[model samples]
Target: MTYSKLNISTPSLIINKNNLLSNINKMNNFSKKNKINIRPHSKSHKMIKIAKTQLKYGACGICVATLYEAEKMVENKIKGVLLTTPITNIKDKVRLKNLFKLSDSFMIVIDNIYSINFLSNIVKPLRKKINVLVDCDIMYIGKNKISRTGARSIKEIISLAKIINQNKYMNFRGITAYAGDIQHINNYNKRSNEAKVRYNYLKNIIISLKNNNLDPEIISGGGTGSHELDAKSKLFTELQPGSYIFNDVEYNNVSIYKSNNKHFSPALIIGTSVISRINKKQYVVDAGLKAISADSNLMPLPIEPTPIGTKYSFLGDEHGKITLPKSSKIELSLGDKVYIQPAHCDPTINLYDKCLILDENKSIKTWNIDARGYG
Candidate 1:
C-alpha cells in the first residue's frame, strides 16, 4: 500500500529507502574494497527483506542475535545463519539442534567449555557438524569487568577453541571479539586505539590456536563503530556491523572514519503526531517510552516538520514533550505529524511489528518485522 506524508499514522517507524540503500551500498563497497566479509547483523531491522538486500549487495551471511531470528532467515532460504549468542538452556539447545537440522549452514558462539560440551553432546548423535565461533572478551578491563558474554582471557579463548576442535559435532569456524564499550567512544583516535588492543589480543589468541594446530575459518566480530578499524586490521575475516543499516542517534555520536560522512545516513525514524500543546512553545507528541525507546537517555530528534531549535523530552510512557521557539514560523496544528529519529534503533525497532518503507518519491511500503519479539 502506498502512503503519502499526510496520511501516515502517528508513532510509526519510517525507513527512508534512499538513505537505507545508500548506507547498505557504502558498507558493502567498503567491505569489498578492504577484502573482508560483512555479516550484517539482522538484530537491527529483523526483517527478511533487508537481510536479502544485504546479501544481494555482497554480504557473506547474516548475523542473528537469537535462534528465532536465525530460524526466520533459514525458513526464507537465506543461507549461512550465525547465532551470535550461545544457547545454554536445554530447551534452547533442543531448538538449536532442530534449527541445525533444518538450516543448510548454521552457527553459534561459544565462550566456555560447558556450552561446547552441551552443544557437542546434542549434535554428536545426529553426526551433524555445527559451526562454532569462540567469543573473546578483548575489551579493556573495567573497575567491575565489562558485562558482556565472552571468554575473558587468551587462555580461555584458546581453551574454548581447543574444545570446539576436539568435538566431533562442532567445527571451529573462528572467533568473535566485539567491544561494546569501545563502540561508542565518540573519539575516533581513542576508539581506534582501544580497538587495536582488542585486535592484538584476538591475534594472539589466533596464534595460540594455530600453535595447537587449530585453524579458524572465520574470525567474526566488529560493530558499526569499529568497522573501519576492523577492516584495516586485516585480522578478522568476517565483520559484523549491525546498526549501520539504520543509523540512530546513539551511533550518530561516534566519530569513526565514515561516521561523520554521508556514507551512513539516518534512515530510521518514528513518525509521531503532535497531540497536545502546552503553552505557546511546548507541545506533547504521541510517541513516548511505549512507542519509541528512550533507554539511551536521549530524546527522539524531530525529523519531519523539523523546525529549527526544537527540542524533544520524554514526559511519560504515552507522551513526549517537544519545545519549539515561541517566535518560530513553523505552525503546528493538533494533528500535525512529527517524524522522530530514535536514540537507539535496535530496541526501538523491536517495539514495532512493521516498518514503513518510504520510497524515493515519498510513497510508503510495508515491511513486516518478521523477527520482532523473537528471543
Candidate 2:
C-alpha cells in the first residue's frame, strides 16, 4: 500500500527500496570490477531478505558478528555464513559445530590455540572440518601486535593457522584483519595511507604463511570505510563491508573519500510525526534519544517534512526539535510526517524490530530486523 494509507507511528525506521538496491548494486559492481569478493556484513541491515538480496547481487557470503546471526542465516538456508568473531564458550562452541552440519559454507575465525582445540574437539563428532580463519591483529598501533588488538603478532597468528591446518576437524581458510578503529578516520588521505600500510603488513604475513606452505585461499576483512582501498589492494581476497549498503550521516560526510561522497545515498530513516508546534523556526517531533542512535557524535539529518535545509536537535528521550530557515515561507503543522537519516545506521537499527521500506512505487513494506538483540 502507499505510505499515505498506513498509520505508521512516529520514530519508525524507513528504508528507501530503490536507494537500497542501487547502493547494493553500486558496491557489488565496485567489488567485481576490483576483483574482490564481496561478503557484506549482516550487522548493518540484519534482515534475512536484505542478506539474501546481497547474495543475489554477487556477495560471496554474509559476515555476521555473532553466532546467533550465523544460526539465523543458516536456518534460513542462506549459504556462505561467516561468523567473524571467535567462539569462546562451550554453549557457543556447540552452536558453532551444529551450524557446521546445517551449512557447508559456514565459517569461523580463531585468535588463539585454546579456541582452536576447543572447537576441534567439539566438532570431531561430526567427522568434518569447519572453515577457519585466523584473526590477525592489525591495529597498527603500539610497538607490536601484542600491544595492539586482534590475534597478537604475526608469529602468533601463523601458529593458529598451523594448528588449524594440522587438525582434520578444521579447515584453514585464511586470515582476517578488520581495522575497526581505523574505518572512521575522517581524513581521506590519512585513511587511505593507513589502510595501505595495514594491507602491506598483512601481505608480509601472507608471504610468511606461504613460505611455510600454508598459503591461504581466503584472506578476509575489508570494511565500508576501507572498501575502496580494500578492493584495490591485492591483500584481502574478500571484503566484509557493512555500512555502504545504508549510508549514515557520518559515512556520507567526506570521511571515506576525503571529499563529499555522492556514491551511496541514505536508504534508512526515522519516520516521525510532528507533535508540537513550538514556534515558526522551532518545533518538537516525536523522535528523540531513544528513537535515533546517539552513539554517533553528529545528530540525525532531517530529510522530510521540510523546506530544504531543516535542522534537527535532541529534545528528550521521546522528543526532538527541528528548525527551518529564518526566511522560509513554508509552515509546519502538527501531525506532519517527518523523516530523518540517522548518524549511525548499525546500532540505530538494533533499536528496532522492523523497518518501513518504501518501494519504487512509493509504497511501504515492512521487513523485520531479525538479528536485533541476537548476542
Candidate 3:
C-alpha cells in the first residue's frame, strides 16, 4: 500500500523527497561550478541513504563528527571518510585501527601533537598510514574569543606538521581552518568579511607551510553558512558543508541566500499529532523537546495546520504547545497531524532512530538513521 504524510505515525522525522533532492543538486552544482570538492558533512543527516545521495550528486567524500559515524559509513562501503573531530580516547583507538583497515581513504583532523602521537602509535603498529589534517583556529586575537578547534598559531601548526611528517605512519594531508562562530552571524556582510579574514589567515598559514617545505593539498573546512565565501576564496581545495542538505530555522534566519531560492529548502520535518485542545487557539502536540531538538533556541514552526501567526512552544519532553490567533481560519481537532520544521536539523535528527522518507508522489518509505546515537 502507498502511504502519504497523513499515514505516517506521529512524532516521526520526515524527509521531503523533492526538497531533499533539490538541496543535494544545488550544493553539488555549486561545488562543481566553483571547482571545489564538496565533502558534505554526514553529521547533519546521519543516514546512509542521504550520504549516498550526496556522493551520487558529486560529493568527493563524507565528513563525520565522530569516529562511530566514520565506522558506520565504512560499514556501508562508503570510502573517503574524514573524522572532523580530534579523537584522544584510548578506548576508541582499537576502533580507529579497524577503521583504517576497512577504508583506504580515511583521514582524521588533529589540532595538537598529542592527538597526532595518539593516532600515530596505533597506525604504526598496524603498519598503516593515516592521512591527518591540522585543524587551525582562524579566529584572531581579541576579535573572536570563542574557540572551536584547531592550532592557535602558525608556529604551532608548523610544529605539529613536523611531527606528523616525521612519523612513518602519518601522512600530512592538509589544513582545516574553519571559522565556525562566524557562520551564524546574521548579517551577510559581517559573515563574509569575517570569512575573508579567516581565509586570509588560513592563506598565510598555507604559505608558511609551503615555505617550510610542507604543502597542504587539502585546505578544507566550511559550513552551510560560509560555503559561498569559502568557495570563492580559492584557498580551500575541499569544502565541508553539512547542513545545506536540510536547512533548519536557525540556518534559514541567517541564510546568505533567501529561503525562497530553490537551491536549499527545509526538507526535514517532525510530524506531531494534536493530543489535547485547551481552547480554540491553544492545542498541545505529542512532540516537544524529545522529538524536536531545542538546542538552537529556535522553536519549530507549524507547517500542516500552518495558519498565519501560528506559533509553537515546547511544553515539555512529550508535549508541544501550538497557539493560533483567536480568529484564525485554520481549524484542527485532536489527532490531527501537524508537521514541525525543526530549528536545528543535526541534533533533531539524532533524536530519532528512523525517518519517514516522503517522495514526490506522496509515497513514503523508511530510512534508518544508522549513525544516530553512535556519536
Question: Global lDDT of each model?
Answer: 0.83, 0.84, 0.85
Show model 1 residue runs off by greater than 4 Å: 1-4, 140-144, 258-260
TM-score of each: 0.95, 0.94, 0.95
lDDT of 3 by residue, 1-375 (tens): 122237867899989888899989998888889999999899998889999999999999999999889999999988789888899899888998999888879989999878987988888777878899888888643266778778899999999988888889889898887777877886777787777777777888999999998999898888888888788788989988888888888887785653334336889988888899998888999998899998887778776546767889999989999898777976678888778899889999999999988887777899999998854
For candidate 2, the clash count comes to 0
- For model 2, residues 1-375, the per-residue Cα lDDT tens digits are 224433687779988888899999998898878888999999887889999999999999999988888888899999888888887887776677789988889988888888888888888899887899998878754223333336867788778888899998888988888877667777778788877778778888999999888999998887888787777777889999998889999887646654446668888888888899988888899988889988888889887546678889999899999888888888888888777899999989988989988887776778899888857
TM-score of decoy 3: 0.95
Top model by TM-score, which number? 3
Query: Positional deviation of 254 in candidate 1, in angstroms?
Result: 1.5
Model 1 RMSD in angstroms: 2.2
Q: Which has the greatest lDDT?
A: 3
Show how many residue pairs clash in every candidate, following the order shown. Answer: 0, 0, 1
Give the per-residue lDDT of model 1 (tens digit) for 1-375.
Answer: 123255788889889898899999999899889999999999999999999999999999999998889889988988888888878988787787788888748788988888988888778768778888898877645323575888888778778888788777878888887777777787888888777777777788888888878777888888898889888888889888998999988887788784566447899988888899886778898998988887896667776465767788898898998888666876677887777788999999999999888887776789999998857
